[model samples]
Target: MMAPEDAALNGHETDKISVLIIDDDSQVCRFLSKIFTGMGYSVSHELTLTQGISHIFSGRVDILFLDVNLPDGNGLEAINTIRHHPSPPEIIVITADDNVDGAEIAMKSKAWDYIAKTGSSKNFRFALERAVEYRRQKKASLSRNDIRREGIVGESRGILKCLEKVAVAAHSDIPVLVTGETGTGKELFSRAIHACSPRCSEPFVVVDCAALPEHLVESTIFGHTRGAFTGADRDRTGLMKIADRGTLFLDEVGELPLEIQKKFLRAIQEKKFRPLGSKTEIHSNFRLICATHRDLEDLIKKEKFREDLFYRIVSLTLHLPPLKDRGEDVAGLALNHMKNQHGANLKNGCIMSRPFMEELQIYDWPGNVRELFNTLDRVCAEAGEGATLFPHHLPEHIRAFNIRHRYAVRQTETPDPETGSFEGPLVPSEPLPPFKDHMEKNKAEYLGHLVAVTQGDIKACCRISGLSRGHLYRLMQQYDIKNNADS
Candidate 1:
């Protein structure tokens, strides 16, 4: 028998394609196992129909080489039951009985292919290959649909791991707490969770705790009766009520006031709350999803957030990894963001420079996705009729930070004896780049100075610099030089 790890790494794919053989004859099982195993399939064999059915229901097998005749029972009798399984493996029936009626019966039961044991080995090989190909195509189509339906992008391990948790969370009814830095798409993930859950058809209500005023927090959340307060002229419904039989997403949930935490806790626990100035309490059935960057544990120690409230809200948690930690995902995200032309405010068709994209990967995005998108938006606008975004198109601070970070790294690797004992990062007098890159950098600096001195007067700069309008614009594009405030 192949080791479990070896079996799992079959073929070029990370996940092995599994094949199961159901044959009472030990010699036949051994003969078929060699062929399937040699073809890079994880193979298993059982001697009886019951054992084969048990293996099939375990869901590990992708394709089954089922023998119609078994010692304990006939495999043809259980074909319908196996075919109807939720994740049934494709079946290829093989038997020496050479019974035409049995082949017809297997086909009617949805067996992928039927073969006679007396058939040539070549024909059997072709049948097994077709069965595996069918399984692969089916799995690929389902995987693609799953990726799109999730609305989450990125191939980083962190993102893939988070998505696994999201899928698991969707099956159960529990409070989910999403904790991440601002702009890490907490609300987006929360929406995806709701969309995948059982209550997806119902309303998905959002409550921005940070945006809610302290004075109106109670009335806004629990609602109020007619003439309850100075401005309560009519009866109003609360967000919790609107989210009944659905999901309630509380963004920046940590900003919720401490006084209201107890009331929120009780409402969550009892599923009932009394609106302001209302004589009777109303019931609401809503799934809770909360998101915040704040650490509830630290807040709990300081009494800023109630411990009971924290426990009530955090039945499960998902933390989004910061952009810097995602490695190649930064470049992937930058390109993907540029391709999201429909929702973007900036014009499309502008391209990003290799150097600019490299800098994007190097810099730590403090504001995460939001900051990256904002920078790209400005770059797209400043690019004008130009095709590419260069380092000069970036905000000054980001460019400077990139250069400083690279210089610091270089200095650490090859320290100057004069500055060996440094007080802080030694700022290089000049930016270092290869010969070709340096020439472009020099041209961009000169153009930037000329633009600043001309005060963005393009015609004047063209005349003063003794260059044609076409030539100057071309240089600006080549150097990624942008003079406007948008740059």
Candidate 2:
């Protein structure tokens, strides 16, 4: 390592900025290397793309000078590979070819700059300075913008109501149940709620219930004492204890086994629990936020869920809608997606053609906002400068989607906010459907279908079907789905 004083004197020191040069031409590499070295920039040169990739992983390279036409592989291929690495180095394409097409593709792939190999050394130096300056500004913005979230963009009434609920829930220690379809930003909502809560400074932990192994569920959640199990080599803290005085987000909470649920419920209710193999109890304080796409009511009916636990945890609920319902908010959300994928500097710089917007607006995003964001990110990555993003810019799967529900409106059978249990006195239908008596006839069928598709996961069913858990419970009572006492 260079001494501190020496490093400061040599402005081009590796500690200041590391540059990796990839070019098949030896003379060009040698010439640029001399120029950068004279300027005090620590530089490494690779005559092949393969060696360049190895150098990227082997050393700390801040930026890449990649030749578009390499001996073994194309620069675009290298760019794609580099992007998958952590803290990917910025790339500047150096090509001798006068092909604007190649330069356009390079820009779309997020190259910092594109310069012909025949360009003057002065031109190369200028491009290098510009790229480095741009990188510095972007890095600063990223640090400054840390407080803002990239996903979950919306300000429409429906979205605003959901945000209000989340904010209110964050203020209390009450366990909040977030119900939303897959890819509807439940995790993002959980993070936002945590950020707003008093425990914001503390660690915010997430328990992926669905991904936890069945046998290890107890140890994972409650932790274990040393020598408690065959693999217990050391004492470990459970997620609940680790999240003490913070927030614990239980994602896919419905997937938690009943045995685990029993213990988890006790922890939530008392904020104290004994770890496995330990006689003494440990105390914990965490604001619990449980999110799931399952129907808790149906699960309770089937005895697969604990009713007392449900009542205790679900003091408040926030249901997020699928992207399809949010009117013109789609366009605004799409633009935000573009900005995140590119950068703040690229906002409103590229326009999505009207045809593209029309297609996007009409499509039923089954995966919700997440799918939309991913699609736009990919499109921007492939779209060149001055490029008008038409429908073709979208992935083939999205463009080829049959789109049967483009004009279809959701049909709601139950009242908008289905409140009250089956025990409550019935309110007669305002004057019924054309089928008269059959208006209330198929209620059980609808509930059964919802419950089945969700695999008895009540919360998930409620989110996808757009029905409240309370409403689901009433429907179950009327349908006579047998109750499972074990739950």
Question: Which candidate's lDDT is highest?
Answer: 1
- Summarize candidate 1's per-residue lDDT along 1-487 as a digit string, tens digits: 2223323333254457788999999888998899888888889999989988888887677888888878888888888888777878989999998788998999888889988888788877899899888887776555434532343668898887667557645767888888899888898888888888899999999999999999898888899999999989999999988899999888988999998888999999988999999999999999999999998888888999988888778777888998877867888778877887565445547777798898898889899988988888877765554346767667867876787787677665644589775453555667767755755676688799989988888876664554568998899888788869434
Report residue 107 deviation for candidate 1 (angstroms): 12
Q: Which stretches of candidate 2 lie over 4 Å from their true place?
A: 1-150, 342-351, 381-386, 400-487
Model 2: lDDT to the true structure = 0.76
Residue-level lDDT of model 2, residues 1-487, one tens digit each, is 2224323433433236678899999999999999877866778899999999988987678878999888899987678899877768889899989989988998899888898888899987887777777776675455333333446677777786676566556656777888889988898988988887789999999999999999888888888899998989999999988999899899999898999899898898889999999998999899999999988888988998888788777777778898888856889888776666655334435668888888898777898888887777656545644456766566645654523243122222224445632332335457545532453454566666666677788766555444467976877888775434215
| TM-score (all chains, Cα) for each model | 0.64, 0.51
Model 1, residue 267: C-alpha shift (Å): 1.9
Instruction: Indicate the worst ten consecutive residues by lDDT in candidate 1.
Output: 1-10
lDDT of 2 at 274: 92
The local distance difference test score of each candidate is 0.81, 0.76
